[model samples]
Each structure stands twice: as C-alpha cells, then as structure tokens.
Target: MAYSDIQKTEFNRVTENLIEITWTYVNLLEEFPRLDEQDSMSWKQMFVAWANEFEELYGHTNWIESEKTYPEAVEEFAKEKILQWAGIRKYICVGKHIEGITLNPYEWLLEKGQDVKLFESEAEAKIYLKTNGYTDEDMEFLKFEEVWH
Candidate 1:
C-alpha cells in the first residue's frame, strides 16, 4: 500500500535526519577534509535502496542471528552486508542487477578475462555493454540515472 501524504512527509524528514547523522559519523572515521557532496548524496541514495532490498529479503521474520558476541556480531554482520552490496551496486551500468541464480551480463560485467568489473564512467559502461552485444534500444535502461543519479 502506498503511504499517505503525511506519512511520506514524515518518512522524508526522518530519512534525511538519519542519513545526515550517519554521514557525519562516517566523515569522522574517514577524516578526509572537504569530501564531495555528490559522493555523499550518492552513497545515501544507494544505502537507502540497499536497506529496502535487505528488508524485503530478511525482515519478515524475527530470525535471530547465530553469533556468540551478541549485538556486536550482529552489527558486524550488518556492516559486512552493506559493504558487499555497495561494492556490487554502487557503480554506473546500463541494466544493473545485484543478485541472480546464475551469473549473467545484467548481474555483473566481466572483463575479457572473466574477472568482474565496475564501470568508472557512464561512457565506459555504455561501451562495455555494447561490446558485450547490448543494442542501442537495450541501452535505454541506464540503471544509474534512474536509481543513483
């Protein structure tokens, strides 16, 4: 069901505050001066999308994690999941997807030697897709533009 207008407003406010605080903590750890605003915004968007996917996959049941260290282990597990998902999804691509039963072009691009690759530029991603047999019409997906840009 769709959220009501009030719910949307509240959610937007809450998400904004939560993300800003999280970014502040991240910056404290990174200790880099003057990080790019665009980069933080991109990360915030990607994290939100990943969180939604995570909830869909594992939020229905209150399944307790099996770790001896209690909450710290759970925290570690969550952090690892986010890092892995970011590595996979935080890149420009034509028609990107994160998971699959079998490895395929849409799932992750591979170089000529079959090692996985992430596109550094939109042009590079487009060229890679075409070289791998994606046609002009197929290139219309532009996954990053819709989701991350």
Candidate 2:
C-alpha cells in the first residue's frame, strides 16, 4: 500500500500504532527461535533488518533503545541466547569514544580470557592491533567500524 493513496490523518495514525505494536511484540518475544540458541545471530539480524525495512517503508524512525530492565524471563532468555550466538566463547565490542563505555563488562571479558579496549577512534584501534602484530584471524572477533559513519 502506497502512502500516496491514504489520507494524511489516517496514514499518520496507522504508522504510529503499527510502530508501537511492532516494538511491543519484539520486546515481548525478547529472543527468537523460542529456546533454540544455535540460530540466534541469523535470527536477530533478520528480525532487526525486517524492522529497519519496515521503518523505511513507513517513513518513520524506529528509535534505538537507550537501555531497559528486563524481567527474569527475558533476562535469562537473552543470556542464553547471546552465549550461543557468540559461540559460548569470549568476544568484545570495541567502540571508539572518549567516554569509554564498553558493550560488555570487564568482568565478563576477563572471565573468558578476553581483553577489551576503547580507543578514541576506529583508526586508533586498528593501528594498535596492527602494531601488536595481531593478524586478521587473531583479531577476527574484534570488530571496529563506524556504524553510521
């Protein structure tokens, strides 16, 4: 359905309602594949991509959550799901920011024999890895990129 055919009021109202319902359903489900952890990355990526597509089609922004507290069910579900998605091993998210906010906690990384570092920019992070002679395979799990840049 093209927006051109719909009345402005009707279009705006329906877009708002649909966005709310979509997010509610995603939050409620929390984890995809219903207890199957092996398929998490593919599932989450597909789900997020679908939501992103919907937002584009409707000409609305699906706001990224700042943070949220989850009930026991959702929390447990995410914990297990993430473990499986990341191969039940150590991984790190390197963000280039002066504030030094990490995607994963220090305790979690240390427990898995992993090291996490935050640089002022992606270039710095890559240079550090190269300087340390960390081959691409060795640094395969460390991702550095400007998501929107």
Candidate 3:
C-alpha cells in the first residue's frame, strides 16, 4: 500500500527535524517502502524503525553513556530542538532598552517585562501592542532588519 497523507506529512516532519538537528539523511519514499515490505509493517511501524535505523547508523559514538552520568546528551538534543524551531519560525524579538542593557525579547517577556515581546511577523506585533493596553503615545516600534553574514 502507498503511504497515506498523514503518514507522508508525519514522515516529512520527523525526517526534516532529524535532518536539521542531526544532519542525518533519510529518503522517505525510497526507504519507507523497502523497510515496510521487508518487515510487512504499517507506516507508523516503518517510521519508528526508520528513525531507529538512523540513530543506529548515524548517532553512534565511541564514548559510553548512561542515564545518570550522561544527561548532557539529552540537554544537547533539547537545545538543538529549540534551535531548529527558532530557525524555522524566524521570530523577531521586540525589546525595550532597560538600564542600558538589551535583552532578547523572549527573555524579557519570560521575565514578565511588559516592554518586550516576540512575534513571527511585524503585523502581529503591532496588533498585539494595540490590543494589549498599550497606547500610541506609550509605545514606539523599532524594526531591525537582519543581515546575514
């Protein structure tokens, strides 16, 4: 049987995240069918096997690890997840200068500061401030265009 829409979407999402975070390669269409036929498996089963195969083939290291002593590996994966999401979302941070210090908008918001926010789009930021108790006189919008090096 051919892969369903949901299966295809999920396979794509998982593989894309894996590729972005781990730089691993997995060709879904070619590999999925082969794996499924070889094992007589469903899409979900095939997907899990595919992921495990990637980890085995590409996620190996010489160092030994355990749950108690190697928490950093998990931490590193979480960090990479955050970075991958950030890269995909392309969020722009809105922060006010405070005490001559500038912080990331996300950090400022997390600290309960009212002057900073994060938004995926400039229009959303303007709309949020307009609706959330900020008057025209109380707020000034600053746009920082990103420059890629």
Candidate 4:
C-alpha cells in the first residue's frame, strides 16, 4: 500500500539499541479495537513522538485528550518521544513519493548537518549514495527502500 493509504502504522528496529515503532493502530478501532488502558500506555510510551507528527500534519492541537486517564496523556507524550528517537528536530518536505522515515525531514536534516538526499526514484537515491561518499560496504547496511511500502 501507499503512505497516503495507510491510516496508522509504526517502524521499529529489531535491535535494542535502535528505536522500535510498531504500528498497532492501522485500522484504528476496527482490527484492534478497544485499546486497554495498559496497552494504550505502552503504545504511548513507544510511539509518542510519531503521534505528535499527526498533530503537526493536521495543524491543530489535540481536541480530544484524556485528562482523567494517564494512558491518554502517555500516548500523547509518546509522540514527542518518537521524534526524539528519530533524531528529528523538525519535519521537512521531501519528494512527493519519499516518505515514512522517522528521522528529521530532508531540509531539517540538511540544516542539522546531515547528508539529506531527496530523489525522484530509488535509483537516484542509490546514485547519490555512491557518488556522495558511500561505498558498496556502506550500502550493504543502509536500506534505501521506502519504509511505508
């Protein structure tokens, strides 16, 4: 599926050192209905930063917040945490098809001294990796594929 088609999802690393974000709410209240208080709290802690992106994307503060329950607040907190984990200071606009990365967006990454590459195709991204200092050895470990797919 495409990023636009995906309602909600997550990206997590298998290693303990790397951040792990699991998309547990793709179908919202359908496939996984009724997030228990405990499960919701865990999700909040794990994916808080990601949730924040939605708020920014929508350009509004959360109108429906949970004050009576800690889980709700925790879920919101997870949004911020998710971004922190992704090393993103701000969101950036990338090439239309390139999305789903948890890290800072292209412009933000560039501003922060990261080598940001926005390409129209994966082939372009690969070429950039090769010409811009990446070697075959380095390429082996990097995943250029779009994660949202």
C-alpha TM-scores of all predictions: 0.30, 0.25, 0.28, 0.23
Best by TM-score: 1
Instruction: Supply candidate 2's per-residue lDDT for 99.
Output: 31
Winning candidate number (lDDT): 1
Model 3 over residues 21-108: C-alpha lDDT tens digits?
A: 3322122224223322433234345344545554554354433654432234433443333334333234555445554344634123
Could you tell me how far off, in angstroms, the CA of residue 101 lies in candidate 2 after the best superposition? 26
lDDT of 2 by residue, 52-131 (tens): 44445433333343243223323333444444443443233353332334555322112234544445565676677789
| Candidates, ranked, lDDT | 1, 2, 3, 4
Candidate 2 local Cα displacement, residue 73, angstroms: 23
RMSD to true structure for each model, in Å:
14.5, 15.7, 15.3, 18.5
Question: What C-alpha lDDT, on a 0 to 100 scale, does residue 102 get in candidate 4?
Answer: 38
Cα lDDT over the full model 2: 0.44
Cα lDDT, all candidates: 0.49, 0.44, 0.43, 0.42
Which residue pairs in candidate 3 have backbone atoms (N, alpha carbon, C) closer than 3 angstroms, thus clashing?
A: none
Better lDDT candidate (2, 3): 2
- How many clashing pairs per prediction, in order? 0, 0, 0, 10
How many pairs of residues collide in model 4?
10
* Residue 47 in model 3: lDDT: 40
Task: List model 4 lDDT by residue over 1-149, tens digit each.
Answer: 78899776445222211122343243233422333333556665655545445345433334356343333443434434543343433332223222534363432113245645445466666676688787877555455533210
Error of 1 at 115 (Å): 25
Instruction: Look at candidate 2 and give me any clashing residue pairs.
Output: none
